[model samples]
Target: MIVENKEFHSRICVDALENAKSVFSPLSSEEKQLLLEQMIAHEFKKGEVIYRVGEKPDGVLYLVHGKAKIAKAGIGGREQIVRMAGVHSFIGYRALFAEEESYASATTLEETFLVQLPFETVVSVIRSNSDFALALLKSFATDLRFAENRTVTLTQKHIRGRLAESLLLLHKEYGVGDDEQTLQVLLSREDVAKFSNMTPSNAIRTLSAFAQEGVIALEGRAIKILNIDELERISRLG
Candidate 1:
């Protein structure tokens, strides 16, 4: 379930809107204040669906805290994770910009906080601010580049290489824990398989192989990179 947080004036929400990469950053103070007044803040529990495939976007979504995954369901009800979003990231904007229903679903990986900017308000700002429009275009271009790279990784890489790359990606996005080895984010085995574009059994086998090779250490959902160089080599060779 999702809870609507009435305290939209919280510092995190304000920072999310005013941050350098924010779409609303180019607006004047008065404009931003007005926009904030119309925004809604939502808190979602771990595993809760933020939005589902085919749903119409009500607004622009900006993550203020926690992690989430954007994925699409495939044949036989299999899921393929397209991307993982962290704090300060934007999700669902692609469909909103295209004026179409969402092609993928977004779900929280942990307890998450988000600020939603009303669609009409965002549209009005884009029309009045050329800089904001350009920013949006740049964001679109960056997302396209990532999509292109991921397409190659999923199709061309071997199972081992795919899992290695997925682990590396998680390390990059969430970084390490206090030990400087274990990843901070913990994802279920199914999520790992979906993100790596492989079946759960395949993913599990590959992970065990890596563990035996001393490339990584796994403790339940916690993954520790014991040999970053070897992991990178696998990804590069694939």
Candidate 2:
């Protein structure tokens, strides 16, 4: 996916440090305003590519609305989702720091709103603002921590466990449905496979098996949990 630097003009800008509070601690108003000046809001349509693998790294992109996935192509051009990103999170810095091209890709899972900060501009601000720099560091640490957990789940878990963990993650990131049992996100089977670290066919088969076991109830793209507690137990066991 490509991230184009489109100009935006707004009467006011967000308090960048407050927006970064998810990773950075609180900041002073002066610092927030200073950092905000370096940001530009960008809108992305659903299914649009944000950045492609091997593309030059440009900057730190933040999610203001909607969601996205950090992914990489696996064997045969299949994709594997490494992370799910939403409001207040940062994306597209893996290559920027190394001064190399991106190793993975990022794309909007839905119509998304983002704040794109040029890498050099942000680093310049960070150089002067201790809070901003620390926040950026914390963001990096958060990504790393999630990566470590994902490595364990994808590498060690059984198929059921992997699926369960993926669903749980979806529930956390996307939320439950009106029925309070169904996952809210409408992910394609391929996306599910990518997120679950399984082949598309395997994800389909296991989900079907779960249906047979009365672990879940499916309605086209909507999946309602029939026995979430048991699913959790199975995931834990795996």
Best by TM-score: 1
Per-residue lDDT of candidate 1, residues 17-86 (tens digit): 7777676677788778877788777888999999999999988898888999999989998889999988
* Candidate 1 deviant stretches above 4 angstroms: 1-9, 20-24
151-208 per-residue lDDT for model 2 (tens digits): 9989999998999888888887778867899886778888889899988999999999
Candidates' lDDT values, in order?
0.87, 0.79
CA RMSD of each candidate after superposition? 2.0, 3.3
TM-score of 1: 0.91
Cα error, candidate 2, residue 142 (Å): 2.1
lDDT accuracy of residue 144 in candidate 2 = 95
Where does model 2 exceed 4 Å of error?
1-21
